[model samples]
Target: MRGIQLSFNKTQKLRLDKALEQLEYFSSKLNSNAIVTVSDTIPVNHEDGVLKGHGTMELEGEVVATLCGVVERVNKLVYVRPFRARYKPEIGDIIVGRVIEVAPKRWRLEINFSQDAVLMLSSMNLPDGIQRRRTAVDELNMRTIFEEYDVICAEVRGFQHDGCLHLQARSQKYGKLERGQLLTISPYLVKRQKQHFHHIDQYGIDLILGCNGFIWVGEHVEVKDDMIEDQTNKSEQQNNKLSGLASHQNQEHNYTPLELRQYICRAANAVRVLSTLGFMITVDKIMDAVEMSTSKNLNIHEMLGAEFYVLVAEREAERRSSSSKKR
Candidate 1:
């Protein structure tokens, strides 16, 4: 939906017009003062020398917007946040990335940041959840852990003095993500929330809303500490060793169920449509979108059609207008 041109027919054109009109109407009724387009002058009392932030420029003794976005004022500082913006990594932010390189003591990952972030071997706990000094043996088996192009989830552990961003995955929740799809959206659309990891019990899907805009829609897996798991499975492992049944397991055990895969796609499509609509992406909104699709009996690809887009827009418009009235 991004960059690719979509040609709409006459009916679609009319539907989009109606939906957009409602969106604008509700949006204006809520708040319209802080919105500005490119080159629009931002009115500010320059008496105390106000500090202008990103997306603003000084021109002819006036503060002008350099981009189309919403203006945010905090005390004396003001900045505009564009609808489509690059991911800006911050310390402690959860991020999903793809491994690009496996260096001697670290793995370089493309995290949608200004540059690739480094995930040092020492920074992450071993699969056994044991803490010890990493050795040359560990370095040799780095690929056994994560190889190039593998998707991983981690947290920003601050940047080094050299300005390189570093990441860490010390918890059971953060690690390699698999059995799902990864969708990229505008970072500005994703708001940092207290709980980013979500398990949709209804669909058996795990949704990781990474702060870096790399969204993960995958099959849900139970979160458990490896330390506790290994201790509990010690007896099971011994029994399997004696029975010699480990190598005789079914090869199809790794295959994901068809229904679960469809749920993952549904969730991923919800994220895509929200990003295209420039709506604030949230877990609740995503769930609602998926539910709407299900209620309408729409196919996976139909969610991206013009009819669904209009429906989504109308729903969002109504929701916003009602919230505004409440305020």
Candidate 2:
């Protein structure tokens, strides 16, 4: 949250400090820090037969935390949730990753986890809208589907026998992401929810909240089965028709309206501001911040200014305070 470097004037710094202090007070009162760091032994009722969970190890008959995070207890089960660590993928988690290698029958992705995730050619829906076993030709033409360095969205398909993660993009909503700004934030800030894909129709933007902390803000693309046709069209293009088709293609896809681009940037900057404040990122919170900036007539570029940050902090403090009261 405060991991990002920011500049603030004397007054702005004071305002930020006060707002943060208020936030701290509210959070401290609500959550009494059932937290521990590495090597800290968690006090448990041994007579109840404590069972150690992930992030805990029995050291000298004491349950010691192996990570730095909040401690959670459920009856006889005890575990810690790491505050700052690599993303741990769970079954059905939506993730965003970059393709690192296109190997035989599978593509390796860097998913911000300990090991690279595997996207088997068969695990994903092909452009032809057909479901079948992936053939040898599919292996050879894997680049046509996903090239190296392409950013993709998928769900956790579980781990391989050797411990590498596996992913699946079996639906239209999951695939190569394009014409979007990819944002990186701490994984802890993104809480799991019933929905991760958000379409802000007001701005024509689609926001994907990856459990692994990769966020995409981009113009929404209609889900269609035209990917194969698009690929075929690309391969068939020759220098003879390049000049004429280039202009058409550029006019169709390359040009994003200035207004839409501004909106995208504005939304992206709102996310940055929230992340910088160390707040939990949710679609509602992001949209609220964006709406606030819009109501103030703040330009997209100005949203990242120090004054806006202080304003956002104050807003967050007030919001949290009210929320705590409601609870």
Candidate 1, 243: how far from true, in Å?
Answer: 13
Q: Candidate 1: which pairs clash?
A: none
Candidate 2 error regions (>4 Å): 36-47, 55-67, 224-254
Tell me the TM-score of model 2.
Answer: 0.85
| Candidate 1 all-Cα RMSD | 3.7
Query: 1-327 in candidate 1: lDDT tens per residue?
Result: 353245678887787677778778877655588889999999999997799999999999999999998898988998898867798887889999999999989999998878999999998976655567999999999997899999999999998987789899988888888889999888887899888899999999999999998999999978886666457566775675455444434532668899999999999999988888878889999999999999999999999887788788778877876787788
Top-TM-score candidate index: 1
Clashes of each: 0, 0
What's the residue-level lDDT of 206 in candidate 2?
Answer: 92
Q: Rate the local accuracy (lDDT) of all candidates.
A: 0.86, 0.86
lDDT at 149, model 2: 92
